[model samples]
Target chain A: MKLHSLMLAAGLAATASMGMAEKIKVGMITTLSGGGAGLGIDVRDGFLLAVKGNDDIELVIEDDQRKPEIAVQLADKMIQSEKVDVMTGIIWSNLAMAVVPAATAQGKFYVSPNAGPSALAGKGCHPNYFNVAWQNDAYHEAAGKWASENGVGKVVVMAPNYPAGKDAITGFKRFFTGEIADEVYTKLGQQDYAAEIAQIRASGADMVYYFLPGGMGISFMKQYAGSGADVQVMGPAFSFDQGILGAIGDAALGVKNTAHWSKDLDVPGNADFVAAFQAEYGRLPSVYAAQGFDTGLLLASAAAKADVADADAFRAALKEADFQSVRGEFSFGANNHPVQTIYVREVVKEGDVVTNKLLGAAAENHSDAYAADCKM
Target chain B: MSTLLLIEQVLNGLQFGVMLFLMAAGLTLIFGVMGLINLAHGSLYMVGAFAAAATAAATGSFVLALVAALIAAAAAGAIVELTVIRRLYDRDHLDQVLATFALILVFSEGTRWIFGSFPLYLDVPAALAGPVTLPGGIEYPAYRLLIIGMGLAVAAGLFLLISRTRIGIQIRAGEADREMIGALGVDISKLYTLVFALGAALAGLAGALVGAIQSVQVGMGEPVLILAFVVIVIGGIGSIKGAFVGALLVGLTDTLGGVLLPEFFALFTEASSAKLIGASVASMAIYILMAGVLIFKPTGLFGGQT
Candidate 1:
């Protein structure tokens, strides 16, 4: 009996070692604290929800605190100590810029859940870098296109003065053929928007276009409503998200915006995602959540296609675009950025909840204009 | 170039200035009386916002939230003084800065652990929701007007308290000479606690009020804290009057610069070029104002002579 038990224990130990050897490890670094925490948390939750019940891939997570330097350090630790097969989840462009190059240099696959900086979409793009989201400038470009098509003649544009802000304006101008009445840049994360609103009111523009995200967006929308300007207000999806709905309630009502996904998307996959997320978290999922969910599906699909022991094989599988995304029939271009639709949305009152409803879809699987410069 | 635009810009500046005053007052009082550079002042502001938000959510009353914010901030101040800040009174400025910076990290992490890293929302009461027309035929937010009014009222109340109250005499005495007051048999430790609590309460009040206008999230207090530091520096580190004046100056300059810089650039360049240049300069406006003030007045507007 003792000899039989020893043989069984030896066999079990061998099987466990083989399983461990075959498991793929992914390192996820995101802003889990500070001002960006809300979005980061949503992204993390969405990714985890996608990976639920998948046993092949193991995810190691770290919080970067939204600091660029910390992101670099976390990347070093993930690469050197953990020797992760792939790295993912960087919500800010600054953090992505700091870490993605290092991950790619090490030949590790770096999947971005969000934050499509212009540099990565263009000449600086790397083969090992894959973004599951649209180019940072893509949605803003759609907004500009919608504005120009809708007969907005003279418009004032505003954004926080940053690299992303520049990308937003450039995207807006790519489609907006109308004469710009004025363009204003404010400090990043500025709490007050009274001055900008006043400027917009007096600029004599037919419409105002802005690209302020998170809290800055909330502040701007509140102040814009208060300014009582007769001009129409429009922006990208980040300006009016589920996070801001509670704060900006009636103020953000009737604000026209543009995005790839709205809570009210009519697709079966979207309906499932929304229902599941609401049932689990008791809140509506934002576009950030959808992006995050797509990322998890992408990773899991790649894992199923290739043996987790081989990093190169797993990456190749991911690049094939085998997963069914929540965004329906999406694929990555040669630049490893997503080719997907940009939807124009309007913020309207949906009962007690302020939500964005899709107005029209524009530009299907639209590759960024900057991808030509990318040698990769 | 238009008169209406320029006037609107000026009003924007005034509104911004008033907001800054709310942050600076608490900082100046603590610095003047305690002779300590409390870097964790921002954490106090954050604490106030979180307390107000949580309380409001639980009670479904905005008034209760405001009261709770004040109480929580004051209590937190007193506890911190007893536990951590008391040890730093004899330390150098660098040590104080380092310790307070650490405090900020701890406070931010602690708040995240409790709050689960999502932003909380606060709504402006219906009474202050809509817009009112200003003198220039431009409609402005009633909430902003309320903020401006609240800031003025607080400033007035501070002035009266400092000048007319008996505890104010002890505070002034403490500021003048801590050793002398202790020698005079006053419970200096308790007095210190009171002053710190008072300062914290003011900070909490600012946080709760601002939370209504902005997202109440962790680290929201940091930007306001930096602005408050600039306010105190420009106003005269320990002078209430200086904080008030400096806040308005900083606020107006920042707001106007953001509006006018792009327009200024438009005269010499295309709209796009003007925007890029204007955005860059607008961010630097407050720092430029600070530099100008320092060059002219070495001690700050209301700073006492060394």
Candidate 2:
């Protein structure tokens, strides 16, 4: 009996050390097929690239189908059945609203790779939740800042009439102080922007700032170019990223945009990430991919420091955010959202493909506006 | 809004409605003749856009792209009818709906597998690129004007084909009495296949034209498909005239409502909130119209009771 008890104690110690590092299960729920699938696919590819051949972690992925209810269901299954230590990889803001609050309320760690709803930044923020991506307002705020610095007069701003869209306008307005032209709230996933383009022309705004991510961006940029309006275009970088830039073509060229990460960031970490991503995916890595890659590195670094089962230790380790980010010099705010340097990029033609060229930093070490509202 | 802006908005509404008419016309024709509720109609639209994009990229000809769209969509429709849809014609509506829903997944995945996950770019031909200022100094895309003209022409041609041709008489007979038409040796199955293919071709043309304006990507048809269903429901189940009129009404309501509602509400609320609320309400305008129409005329404006 004495010998058996001694062996059991030794066995527990071995399992504790081994299980702490290797047994961390991550549940990545993302849109794999739908209108918004490209962003989610980039995130998944970048994430898988980071965790590739690392025996220290295991991942279970499911498609949310860009549906919020489906996202919630997947989160439930991931938490209850698979026992994931962390959850991440949501695309749309609507889906994030449904999934994030519920998962975090249940004491599970959620590191967002893409979507970061404003609600999560403030009163709804959780100690267990960390957004490796910028706050919802970061890039738009940078756009507003850039416009203000550039002496932009009269701008017409627009976005879909949704929470994230509202957040985008708020962020843009927070920085841009100019003559009010008109604020147009378009339909979500609207294909034809002829009416809106006409309105933009009629408004006589010197420039147009619109946030219609994914396919909407492609349609809008194309139509605006075709309209021959010639007014300059400005937007958050998501609307002019590597993913859909090819579709927009020359329409996107010379457009100024802002982002937290770029493929051409000129940092050693980013260069390696860009090279490895191209080598792996046979395409230029989107900003979404960089965030996903950062997420993977974030989780790995935290796990290396302390067991994810210990909530206090794991949370502290993540707060440190010690991993080298592709964005360079990424840190967590008091609210656990990224405080990173937002860069301005110009849409340029690199050979035959349309991609963004780094202009300069728009905002340095930018944290969210709502960080003060965060209690944790 | 100024009168000039209002006039421009009216044109925008007409353009939108005309496009919706093309989709509704095909959907209504298929439903009227076949009694099959095909959810996969959107998949056909996607196929058409993909075919056009691929052809344009390969051949650098818009005309060829349009031709490929028509042929590819028709071929897809005919093959689907022959393989799976034909069997469901004798079955219930639930089975038809289920099978077509499954086909949406199959076609979407297959297209993605072939063309990849990225969107394909199809530029408007240089002849139609950029906006031309109209009589009132309203600048509009030449391509949009072309779309409006093309939609009206297709509607007229479809009307002529249905009312003036011998094929039209046989189709009407098949709709009224399938067994009698079969007994009359009308080759009912062939007629059905041809009708389905024709509808599919029309959808393909719509997709091809719109693909240049919109992003040519997978699942692009689903939103348009829902709008088409709304158009048909409001126009009556199987009436071409109903589809045309209904399409126009929906188009006008959606477009005008989107432009005017925010302005109307802005008088009472903050412009931002008003715009957001108004835009949402505008999105539901067609559905609300459909509900009102169904409440008053259950058979629709032109549908007949069997």
Candidate 3:
């Protein structure tokens, strides 16, 4: 009996040594405390749901407090001390810009669940970097296309005065091909929209396109509703996502927004994702949640095929993007950003909950314009 | 822009200025009367907003929401004043600042623990949810117009209270010389508590009013607090009249600069770059005004003491 037990122990040790269980350490730095915490919480919950019951993957999560410097410090700590194999979960573009380049340069793999800035999609693209979310311009570009194709004309464009804001306007103009009545750049995180609403009402434009996200969107929608502005409103999904829809209330109803995914999309794995997310988090998932779940699945698929120790093999495996995405027909562009169909969604009241209902596709096989600028 | 549009923009400026005045009033009052720099005044504003939002959610009454805001903020101010703030009266400015800053963190975290991080839904009352036309054919938001009226009314009430009431006399006397008032048989600690609660109630009222139009979430008060500080500095630190005028000046500069500067640059440069340059300058317009004022009069517009 002793000889048999010794032989069994030796066999188990041999199997473990042969890499039967692969462990991948994941470091998630996100805004978990502050105004932007909702987005990060959703992303973290969705990511965890996808990797549930998997003991092989260890995730180290830290709150960034919506500060770029804190995010940089966390990234450095994750890379230097935690020695994480992969890093993810940055929501804002500025924070992503602060953390991603440095992490990727230090030989740490970064899979962005959101915030695909133009710089990273273009000349600053790194081999170890993968953006599971759409490029910064993709949704806005799709919104522009939907506006132009749906008989909308004479639009006033507004965005925060930042790089992503500029990218939003540029992307909209790329496919809009309509009379641009005016372009307004407001201060970032500004709550008051009275002046802007006054301008919109006076611009004589039939439609107003804006890209204010998070709480700013809520403020704008509420103020715009009260102002009795006669113009129609449209924006990207960031402003109308499930997380903030309740706060916007009925003001967001019937407003059109473009996104790469929706809760009602008739796609494989989407219904399951929505149902599972609701079951786990006891709430409807937002677009940010969808991106995070897809990111997890993609990482899982890559990890199943290749060990992360082999950088070249892991990169090739990630490039394949073999997992089923909630967005459906997902593929990575040459720049490692997502290339997928963008859908137009309308904010609707379903039962008692405010959510999005898929309207139709705005753009098919939509790829970013900056992909050509990437060398690798 | 058309004349009507420009007039509407000015109204927007006035509306914004009125809101800033509400915040600056309380801050200036506390600083003037207490001789203590309270960095946590914004936290009191946040507390009021959260209280109002929660009350509105529960009872579905706007008036009840406002009342709850005032009561909750005043109670919080009294408790904080008695428990934490009373101990810091004799400390140096740096120590007071550090302690109040710590109080801000505590309030922020405590509120987050109770309310979560998502912004609460606070809508304009249905009666005031439409546009009101002014005499010049300028359409303005009725809610904003109401805010301006309320602010003016409060300003008038505050002036009257300061000029007529016995407590106002006591407060003025305390501001002048706290030790002298205490020596004259006045309960100085109780007066200090009352003053703090009064300032907090005003801040709470401002928060509830503005939260109806803006996002009611954590950190919402900090930006307004910064603006309030700018108003007091540009005006005079301890002068309510100065706060009122300074808030309006800053508001007009911010709004008009944002709207007109871009238009002004359109004549000399292309539209997009003009917007870039104009916005960059406009964001600095208030700071520039503050600097210009300081360069001319280092003691501020209405400052009396060195």
By TM-score, who's the top model here?
3
The TM-scores, one per candidate, come to 0.93, 0.95, 0.96
Candidate 3 per-residue C-alpha lDDT over A1-376 given as tens digits, one digit per residue, 9 for 90 to 100: 0001001101222223335446678898888887788999888888888877655567888888889998998888889988999999999999999999999999989999998999999999999999999899999999899998999989999998988888999999999978999999989888898888988888899999999988888999999999888799999999999988888888889999999999999989899999999998899999999988998888878877788898898899999999999999988888888889999999999998989999999999999998899997
Per-residue lDDT, model 1, residue B17, is: 76
Tens digits of per-residue lDDT for model 3, B84-163 = 99999998989999999989888987888899877888887889989888898887889999999999998899888888
DockQ, candidate 3, vs. native dimer: 0.74
For candidate 1, write residues B1-306 as lDDT tens digits: 677677766766776677678678878877888788998888888899899988987987888988999999999989989999989988998988999898888888889889767677676766777788888676667877887788789889888888899788888787788899999988988888898998888888888888877778788888888989988889888888999899999988887787778778889998778878887888888889898899999889988885
Model 3 misses residue A253 by how many Å? 1.1
lDDT (0-100) at residue A308 of candidate 1? 52
Counting clashing residue pairs in each candidate, in order, gives: 1, 0, 0
* CAPRI-style class, candidate 3: medium
lDDT (Cα, tens digit) per residue for candidate 2, span B203-300: 89889998898899999999999999988888888899999999999989998998888888899999777888888888888899999999998988
Q: Tens digit of lDDT per residue, candidate 2, span A1-376?
A: 0001001101222233445564567888988876778898899889888866554556888888888888898899888987888999998878888998889888899999988888899989999889999889999999998898899999999999877888899999998888768899888889999888878888989989999988899999988888878888999988999999988888899999999888888876889889999999899999999988999899888877788888899899999998888888988989999888999999999889999999999999899998889997
lDDT of 3 at B254: 92
Query: Clashing residue pairs in candidate 2, if any?
Result: none
Best by lDDT: 3
DockQ of each: 0.67, 0.71, 0.74
The worst-scoring run of ten residues by lDDT in candidate 1 chain B lies at B116-125
